[model samples]
Target: MRTFDVPSAPAFWQDPHSFFSSSETAQGGVFASGDGAVSVLGFDALDQLGRNPALDGHPFPAGGMGSPGLDALLRWGLFALTAPEHQPLRRAVAAGFGARRIETLLPLLRRAAVEHCREAARRGQADLVHDVAAPLAGLAFCALVDLEPLQAGALVAAVEEIGRQLSPDSAPDGTEAAGQQAEAVLEMLRALEAAGASPLMRDIAERLPPDTPARPADLVAALVLDSIETMTAGLACALDCLLRQSGVAEAVAADRYGWPLAVQEAFRLTSPVLLTARMAQADIAWQDDIIRRGTTVMLWWPSGNVDPRRFERPFTFEPLRPQARHLAFGTGSHSCLGRQLAAMLAEELAAALLPKEGQRAIRIGETVFLQRFARLPREAPIRFA
Candidate 1:
């Protein structure tokens, strides 16, 4: 119940496992980071954070939301919505990511993976982050949204530039840098608009409320950018996890059916999305403390994933670990709509990238953290043997 200034130490970003453990020691399961951000640690607290009705991802001033520029975006996008307004969009997005949809896209996913991996083979060494993860998100996203696949490379570039400018590793110059990155993300949408709306935009328009102000292209373009950020980072993280754990690839190879579990375990350990701001929908009591409405509490995921009380040796990579529980895609109505696709992409990519028998094991290079976000990696290079 006491306040400790949030430690923004370098170790917290580069070596978070120890950093978060030290935070648990210093602040217990819940403590306020003097910067008006309170981190809730531990697996139990995370479960509560997920189910707690009073907590939601509505964003706040400190959370980098509610700019006049983002009005149409938040109004139409699932990332910022809450309650009744969020339900419809959530269902629509969910339908888009249904098992059938992912299954239908599997062939295309495999084709794209083959193309990227083949390119990596030709080069003998490639950054999987760029060659594998980014293209996977770009091409798969376009296919899902019914957009022309030709625009994918541009989306990949825009998403990367946007991520680079916005990540914590970038050491943002201040509000101006953020404003610039924000404009760049919007420009990605403009680029999409200039090319004209595809059937994807029309489908999204049918799902959104008729009163929504933005045209279908404008709204869908904004939403796809949001999806691109999360999807790209997530695929990169999952693949990076596989590269980090040598034993994992063997386990995956032994039981190709278990790639899903490998991907799940990967998500548990090094999720790109570590911090989520949840505004108190109403005054809510937690562990004898009060969370006031308008309060933006931070749900720090790294602490929860490694909470000693839950998984034994939480940091150890265990692809076949029984019963994985993670918040990589968040929870509740605000949970990621493209989550299944991300997982599917990860699973399929693992199958594609797995080194075959008699072939040398894939060699992994060192990790480079994204400048704008410490939790996410910037590049993961690999050399096929």
Candidate 2:
């Protein structure tokens, strides 16, 4: 087996397709990366790994492969564990982001779009990511997950700053920016607690048993941190997909139920959160090698999401594609509990931002991809008239 020496940095993430293909062709689906990590490619392989009861999704104290302070956000959260250990907290947090609850948040979601429009009106140009997607995601997270809407501005900053913890430069150790961001978010939450606890927080606490591994505050903080980072990335990238492809956008716009389809399709393409790592619980036989137990296995979802065998015209964004079910949110016990809510949020924003009658198609300016984390558009300037 050849060593897959892809560096653990943004440069490799820049073209995961090339890496996936080269790695797969070179090693027949499994190889060792430069970071001493084992990675697997292909849609079938990823799905099988995701459902492998032997592999653990959360195998780290702080969220896997992240910096200390940034990962500390999930220190009390269940994000770093698989089933059995993670189930109770997952259920508790899932309810808060349920579809019905999301429906209640429709007004806030629409308000985010309205506020973006207002910002554009004032400046004639603005970053859709920072101004529209990030703030919208931040506020939604604040109300639904944090239950502390007043700290939204700080949450936005913290989420952005902490997200940098995933950058190649900060890998394996928390960066100074990450520490500062964590301090900001935690301080804000601490202040909010001094005032009073919201029903959402209390409900989450009540749901967990006395012996639960996750503390109530950790659960709240984890949910808050997640709500902003990846959600914001998914929203920004999905919109970028539609805005850049007029043919696909027009097709989606023509359908009454197209917004969600567009979101799902774009999700398959970008897969904002690209790779998820799992630890093997038992020795597994690979093509010609033995994968020892306790070895870390990286499931590259972006590769699977665009696997030609699974997705016809894998590179194209085709809404309502029959084989459209993708692993943007992963699968099995550790799947993203907020999948439905995330989809709803994206669809709502798409509906609001999709070109209206007599209005110009939304235009996108230069974009900067995060490379790590969600591959999100760090700077997505956009406008419509």
Candidate 3:
């Protein structure tokens, strides 16, 4: 197998798009690390791997992410579940994000978007991400679990604290302070459930079987953990794409109906949530080698999204391209459960903010990335007219 040392690859950390678009990954589409982990880069290969039952979706190793709270997040989170345990929990959470439910939240999302845009317009300047996208995501999250939108700031802070531990650059030895933060979040969730204040907890309880291993609060925590960052990142990236391209923002703003296609293309180009992993449950056959059980297979989403074999002019942004679908949200059983919510948030925010004619946002700073799966920029500054 071709070797690609992912940990030492500075480009992969500093600038993932260029790293994945390189000729090495475009040619072979597969690589093996010194630690025996395999990376799959082809769209078709990733699709096949996602569907393969021999691979387990549970992400954490046996020793866990270092603390009981962190370990619980890894073990009980929806994306990390496997087989018998996964289906029921998925169904429960999926109920909250159903079409009827999302439709009910549309007005709320639209109102929040308009309010944020109004504030930006009054100031004549704003951070496109922080002032707009992040707040919209926070409002959507509060709506989902039945919290007041006013509580969004505090809720977002708690989730971010928990999420920091999952970053690649997080300290190897979990800090005592970090552990306390995780514990506090978990304890608050449990307390909310006990007091009957969490509608998400009730939704899960209604759908989940009586003997289920996971607590209702755990499922709610997982949903909160997964929802805000990805939705916020996706909206910011799509908005960034529109602002950078010359006529695209004006065209999308005029059409209204075109935002979905625009967001889809942006997702293809930027490919948020760079990678996902699965553990081989049994021996598997590859092109010229065997993948033994217990091996970790990393699915590189950016590589698959830009595969030359699958996309014509793969590097270019074309919303109306013939093959518009991509693996930004992944595929198969463990695919993102909140994909619909993410798309809705992006479209609504774009529709609300983009006005008819000459008023629009102009980018003032370059986008950046942190050592995390989410490709969201720390600051994407813009001025509104």
Which structure among the candidates has the greatest lDDT? 3
Off by over 4 Å in 3: 7-10, 25-28, 59-63, 172-174, 197-199, 253-257
Worst 10 residues of 2 by lDDT: 355-364
Span of 10 residues, lowest total lDDT, candidate 1 = 65-74
TM-score on alpha carbons, each prediction: 0.85, 0.87, 0.92
Better of 1 and 3 by lDDT: 3
Q: What residue pairs clash in candidate 1, if any at all?
A: 167-372, 167-373, 168-371, 168-372, 168-373, 169-371, 169-372, 170-371, 170-372
Residues 44-137, candidate 2: write the lDDT tens digits: 7678767777766645554453445556665654446665666667777665456776678778777776666665645766677877778777
| Sequence-dependent TM-score of model 2 | 0.87
**How many clashes show up per model?**
9, 0, 0
User: What tens digits encode model 3's per-residue C-alpha lDDT throughout 186-228?
Assistant: 6766787898886667877889878887788777766666778
lDDT (tens digit, per residue) of candidate 1 on 1-385: 7664554776565556566664473334666766566667667776676678777666424435424443333455665556655666556555545677667898889888877877777778888777788778889888876667886887677656555544554444443444444465566556655565544544555676665455555555556656777787788888877766666657756675388888888888886667766777788777767767777677767777777677787888776666488877766556667778888888878777775553332647677765333255667778877
TM-score winner: 3
Clashing pairs in 3: none
